[model samples]
Target chain A: MIAILSGGVGAARFALGMRQIIDPTEISIISNVGDDEVLHGLHISPDIDTVTYTLGNAINPDTGWGLKNETWHAMDALTDYGGITWFRLGDRDLATHLFRTQLLSEGKTLTQVTDRIRKRWKVQPRILPVTDDELRTVLYSVIDGRAQQLTFQEYFVRYAHKPAVSRVIYEHSAEARMTPSVIQALENAEAIVIAPSNPILSIGPILAVPGVSEILSRRRERVVAISPIVAGQAVKGPAAKLMAELGLRQSAYGVAEYYKDIISAIVIDDTDAGLADQIRLLGIKTFPTNTLMTSPETSKNLASAALSMISGEPV
Target chain B: MIAILSGGVGAARFALGMRQIIDPTEISIISNVGDDEVLHGLHISPDIDTVTYTLGNAINPDTGWGLKNETWHAMDALTDYGGITWFRLGDRDLATHLFRTQLLSEGKTLTQVTDRIRKRWKVQPRILPVTDDELRTVLYSVIDGRAQQLTFQEYFVRYAHKPAVSRVIYEHSAEARMTPSVIQALENAEAIVIAPSNPILSIGPILAVPGVSEILSRRRERVVAISPIVAGQAVKGPAAKLMAELGLRQSAYGVAEYYKDIISAIVIDDTDAGLADQIRLLGIKTFPTNTLMTSPETSKNLASAALSMISGEPV
Candidate 1:
């Protein structure tokens, strides 16, 4: 089985490409639930849904989120009914939320509902949330010199991530217990791949869950990570800004350093060829390739490159 | 103050007409909630929404349900996801459900949420549900001689009410308490006008609520019911078939007999003029006019006619 540590768009795209190249059922995605939040009483799992929709070919390609050809009727009506429409939910997307909310209200755990929804979407990959417990990624922003933590969505969506970040905190990371399926995937995997996702917002919170980093550290030889930063810029999201804010060099080398202790190899973009030797000096093997997945074919190439590296083959 | 017992299209149109002639704030609409159901986990109150949309002039004039110029992207995507899509929830309609579901999850009562929603729509009428409790109207039918109790939507929307209903049961009627506002409206109303809605499925369930009929009975002199049946047939729904199944004449006189104990006046269609004297024999005054409300103006005229009858004036 192939285990993938995912964030959102980038990882989801890579996973989708991997499904095209490999038997979809052979893949198991351990998605970050840290971005989960209750929006208008529905459990909104950004990473999980992104991965599910991307793999199922249901994602809105233009937005890189939500369902394809989505209608904003619900959001329009919601606005008319005095509801907050900043975080827009498409009608079809609302159905997923509605089903999830109902299932959760009926006492089903997040894992159970996720499985049911995935089944309904006919997704082949065994998508598992890192944990069922509440694990919120809180952004501590300094607005006018007053520090306050905001929910991930509030900072990302409501404020458009314009808030100056002082620090980021994962509220339930310390208390969350990893699901047995996730632990088993990590333990039994022949190879582990971390997709080119936002390291701070996406991958950071996933690793913050107590046992996750420890497990990767123990299985370093099987773990490989693809750099999200290509030519000193993030493919998507606030990864670069967040890395610079956290006092780190905004380069592929910075990403290598971040995962050095837990990964056997780092896949950087061919554009950053000079940094390959420097990254190799950290005792992690370096694979240089076109890591910018601008299309489905490129995404598959990236996944294949990472898989080959994990199998002790040069790509 | 005027109180209207409403159902769907015809009732919504009638209510809209009344709003045009009366100070909307002086009118209270006690809508039928028996058609409410949890679809894909979202609580859908169809009758309540129809009334709200019609009064706010947002209802689709073509279908007489949902929002005007609404898209079906959500339903289309839902069908793609292999979800049930027989009960078409337009994109804008989905928004109402999403907002309502969110508010309900946050512990807001249906009444409070409805008020907030109406305020957003800028509707002037006090739209109140018959009760806050669960009151489902189930139609008992036999397919090949096997009995089953189908939900109101299942019978109405899914089957289009083709199967002959052997009986009708107002589930939770015994336990339902009249909404305080509805009871107050009944107690203090200068006039109570029952819209020309399906008498069995619409007004029947409303009166079945424990204290509602009792209140109407006590103030019978102030209550007036417009006949859904005209020329021996119902304007809409299974009222005619249901009446026949229940062993009653499918005529305006049948409606007068159905509501005779709790109503002082019966308004019939001009086509049913011959039944006026026969309906009056049931101890209720009869007013024959063009009760078929085809447009907003007609709805207002019908409302005025009912109001006039209650005031001891010719309509």
Candidate 2:
């Protein structure tokens, strides 16, 4: 089994690519729950849904999230009642949240609800939330000279990720234990691949889970990470901006440094090949290739290279 | 104030007519809470939304409920997940439920949520729920010689009211108290109008509230009920079937007999004029008219006739 530490859009795109080259049954995605939010009484797991929709081939290519050809009648109608809709939910996409919320209300765990949704979409790859407990990525930022704590969606979506975040804390991570499925996947996998998602907002929360990082560290020889940053910038989202704001280097080198403790190798874009020597100096193998997954072909190639590097094969 | 005891579709149409003939400010609609249901974790007050949409001229003309040109993408998408969708909710109409649920979670009463929605639609006149408490209309039905308890929505929407109901129960009505606004409206109104809705399922739940029936009895001289049953059949819904199933006469006279204790007069269809004498024999004044509200004009005419009867004027 090839387990993937995943987040939203970027990771979903990578999973779409990985499934093309390998039997989808071999993939196990342990998704980040730090970005989970309850809006209008409906539980929304942004990262989980992104992976589900992408793998199901129902994702909107334009937004890289939500359903394709989605209508905004529900969100547009919210304006009629002056309801909070900055975190817009599409009409067709609402069914997923509704199904999830309904099942959760009936006492099903997040992992169970996710599996139900995955099967509904005919997705073969196993998708599990990292932890069933409450694990939220909370960011503290200084706006107008006052410290404000923002939920992941509030920071990334509502605020457009503009606020200079001083700290990113994974709320409830101390008490949040890794789900048995996730632990088993990590323990039994031939290799673990960290998908190129926002490092702080996505992978950071997973690492914060008490036993998750320890497991990764013990199995570091088989772990490989795909850096979201290429040529000193993130391919998408606020990874680049947020990294600089939080005092981390906004480059491929920063990504390698961040995961050096638990990763045997890192995949950086060909454009960032100049940092290969620097990354290798940290005792981590560096595989520089065309990592910008502008198409399915490119994504599949990147996944192949990452897997090859972990198995000590020529990339 | 001219208070109206209300339910869904039929009551909304009557309210629309009342608004046309009188200053909307003079109208106070006390809506039934018996059919208020929570679906997909969203609080859905079917009757309240019907009246609000009708008064705002946004109701679907063909169905008498839901918003006009409403999209069903959300409900259609639910089927993909095998989600329970026997109770279909339109995409645009879902905004009301989402808004109501969010506000209710924030500690607002159903009455407050209804008012917020009313203002959003620019609807005039006060629309108050009979009670903010849990007063569900539960139907005890025998299906294949087995007794089953069904919620109002389950019996009405899910089962299509096919099961023969043995008894109708207003769950928690014994402990439910009428809202102060409803009581005040009844106390201050010059006359009260019971709309042409299902008596057992609609108005029955409102009267089940402890103080509500007492207030109507005290104002019996000024209270009038518009029979939902016309020509020995209901204009819409399962009123006739349920009435007969519950051992009621299932006619205009039966409607009058049902409310005889708390009502002074009733407006029945001209086709049921033969039963007028029998209704009067029961000491309830009867007014015969064309009460089939096929159009807005007909509804307005019916509203005018009912008001004239209360004022002792010729219809």
Candidate 3:
């Protein structure tokens, strides 16, 4: 079994490529829930939904999230009431939130609800949230000389990730324990892949959960990380910008430094070959390759290379 | 000021007629909350929406409820997850539930949410729920030779009102208190109307709230009811069937008898003129008129006639 630590769009795209080289049934995706939010009384797990929609082949290609051919009637109608429409929940995508929220209210765990949803979408991989307990990624930033604390979405979406964040904290993570499913996935996997997602915003929440980082650190040899940074820039989203704001070098070397303690190998884009030796100096094996993943074939090749580093097998 | 005790479709239609004679701002509608339900984590007030839609001219003319050009995309998508779609929520209608649920979760009362919703619909009348507390109408019925207890929506919508009801009870009416707005509307209105809605299922719930029936009975001379029945049957719905099952005479006379204690006068259809003397014998003045309300003009004339009984003015 192969386990992937995932975030949202970037991770979903990486999972799409992972599917090409492995049987989906053999994959287990332990997803981050720090970005999950309650808007309009609906529990929305953005990362989990992104993974589900992308794996189900229902994702909007333009947005890299939400459903293709989705309608905004519900959101549009909400505008008449002067309701909060900044979150952008589409009509078709609302069914998932409704189903999840209703089931959760009926005393079902997030894990059980996610299982039902993925099966309904005909998605083969097992997708488990890192923890069922509340864990919000809160950002501390000073915008216009006034210090403010914002939810991850507020910093990323509402503020368009423009504010310089001083620190990011996972709220309630101190009391959060890994769900049994997630723990079992981490323990039973033959190999683990830290998908190319935002380090602080996505994977940071997963590592914050009690015992998660310890387990990864102990089994470092079986773990490999694909850097989100390619050629000194993030392929999408604010990974590079957030890293820079947080005082980390915004390059492949920086991604390697972030996961160096929990991973034995790191995959960097070929354009950043100059940084490979510097990353290796941190006691992490750096494999420089074409990690841009602009298409299905490129994504697959990237996944194969990352797997090969740990497996020592020719694909 | 004029106040109307209301239910769903029939009451909404009557309200439309009332709007034609009085300035909408001068009208106050005290609506029943017995039929309110929580479905898919959404707080749905079917009667409130019906009144708002009907008065705003956005109601589906064919069904007498829901939006005029509603789409069912959200409900359809729910089917993919084997989620409950029995209640038939439309995409456009979902915004109301979402808005209400969010506000209520934020500690706002149902009365406050309803006020906001009505204003958003451009509805001018003051629509207030009979009570902000939980008050569910539960029906005791014998269906397929088995006795069962059913919610108002379950009996009326899910089962299509086919079960023979032995009795009906307001589940939480004992603990329910009338909202201040409802009490004020009843006390300050020049005339109070009991709309042409099902007495046992619709109006019954409103009266069940504490102090509601007492206020109407104290001011009996100012309160008049428009009988939903014409001749020997209800204008719409299973009002006659339910009344017969509950052992009441299935006629306009039965309606007067049911409300005789609180109502001083009643307006029945011209077809039921023969029952007038019998209803009047019970000490309730009966006015026979063309109460079919087949069109806007007819509805307006019926409202004018009902208003004239107490006001003694040519409306």
Candidate 4:
């Protein structure tokens, strides 16, 4: 079995590429559920849904989130009712939330509902959330010199992540237990690939869960991370800015340092070839290649390169 | 001000007609909520939604319940997830449920959610549910020689009302308090018109509420009921069968008897003119006219005739 540690967009793209080369059923993905939040009485796991939609070929290509050909009628109606419409949930996407909420209300665990939904959508890969427990990423920001914590969605969607970050806390991580599927995937994996996702906001919370980082550390020889940052810029999201805010250099070398003890190797973009030597100096092997996945072909190339590096093959 | 006792299709048609002649804001409709049920954790008030959609011109002209041009993506997805899909909730209708469910979860009363949703749909008429509290219509039926009480939707939609109904009970009528808006409409109305709706399934449950019948009886002079049954047959639904099963004659005279003490006048179809004299003997004036509202013009004509009759004008 091939296991992948995934966040959102970049991770979903890499998984889709990997699915093309192998039997989708042979691949297992441990998705980040740290960004999960209860919004408007609905449980929304942003990363989990992104990976599910991407793998199922149901994602809106233009927006990279939500369902294809989604309607905004519900959101329009919500706005008319004086509801906060900052987090735009398309009508079709709302259906997913409604279904999930119903299942949750009926006492189904998040993992069970996710499995059922993915199976219904015909997604063959076993996409398990890192845990079924609550592990919210709380952002502590200084607004007018008063430190307050906000849910990840409130900081990211409501404020567009514009607030000055003072600290980031992963609430409930100490109590969260890795799900059986997650542990099983790790125990049986032939190779483990970490997708090019936001290191701090996405991957950081995943590693924070007790036993998850320890599991990766014990299996370090088989684990490889594809760097989200190239040179001094992030491929997407606020990864680079977040790295600098958290007192880390905003470069591929910073990414290598972040995963040094947990992963065996780091994949860097060819544009950051100079940093590959520096990344290797951190006691991790480095594979420098064109890692920017601009299209399906580029995504496949990246996935193939990561897999080859894990098998001791030169890409 | 006009107070309309509404059910669903026929009542919606009459309300549509009345809207053309009166300021919609001046109209108050006390809709039957006996049909409401918690389906998949959604509080779906069908009769209220039908009336609201009809008044807003968003109702499906063909199906007569949901919004026009509605997609069934939610229902389709629900079935794909192994959820019960016997009752069809269109995608647009699902939005209504989602908003209402969220509001209810946030501790808002049903009346508050109804007002918010109706206003958003741009429905001007005050569409008040008969009660904010639970008042479900349970249909007791004999299927395969066994008696069982089914929820209104189970009887109406799932079984298609196939089994012979033995008893119809309005559970919670003893506990349900008439909403303030409904009481105000009854007290302030210049004329009260009971739409041509099923006497047992629709109007029966409204009168079953603790103090509603007493209020209507006190205001009998202004209260009028248009017969749902005409010429020993119902225009739609199981009214005829239910009336027969209840050991009442399936005619307009039976409707007059059903509303004997609370109504001052009964409007009977011209086809049922033979029952006019019989109905008049029940201490209620009878007006014979064409009550079948097949078209908007016919509906408008029926509304005018009923209003003129209640106003003591020649019909």
DockQ of each: 0.38, 0.74, 0.73, 0.28
* Order of candidate numbers by DockQ, starting with the best: 2, 3, 1, 4
Q: Is candidate 1 or 3 superior in DockQ?
A: 3
What does candidate 3's lDDT look like per residue over B221-266, in tens digits? 8889999998788899999999999999999899999998999999
What are the per-residue Cα lDDT tens digits for candidate 1 across B1-315? 889998988888888788887888999999898889887667788998888888887889888888898888777766755556889988877878878877888888788778887887888999898988889999999866789899999999988988998788999988988888998888888889888888888888899999888888988999999999989888878888889998888999999998989999988999999998888789999888998888778888898888888875321
For candidate 2, the TM-score is 0.94
Runs in model 2 with CA error above 4 Å?
A144-146, A312-315, B144-146, B311-315
Note the Cα lDDT for every prediction shown.
0.86, 0.91, 0.91, 0.85
Model 2: per-residue lDDT, tens digit, A35-111? 99998999999999999999998999888889999999999999878998999899999999999999999999999
- Lowest summed lDDT window (length 10), candidate 4 chain B: B306-315
The sequence of per-residue lDDT tens digits that candidate 4 reaches over residues A1-315 is 789998998899999888877789989989888888766667788888898998889998887888898777767666666765788887667667767877888899888989988887899999888888889898888766778898878887787777878688889999998899899898778778888998878888888888888988998888899999987898887788878888888998998898989888888999988887777788888888988888888888888888777764321
Which rank order by TM-score, best down to worst? 3, 2, 4, 1
Proportion of the native interface contacts kept in model 3: 0.66
- Kindly indicate the candidate among 1 and 3 with the higher TM-score: 3
Query: How big is the RMSD of model 2?
Result: 2.7
TM-score of chain A of each: 0.96, 0.97, 0.97, 0.96
How many backbone clashes can be found in candidate 2?
A: 0
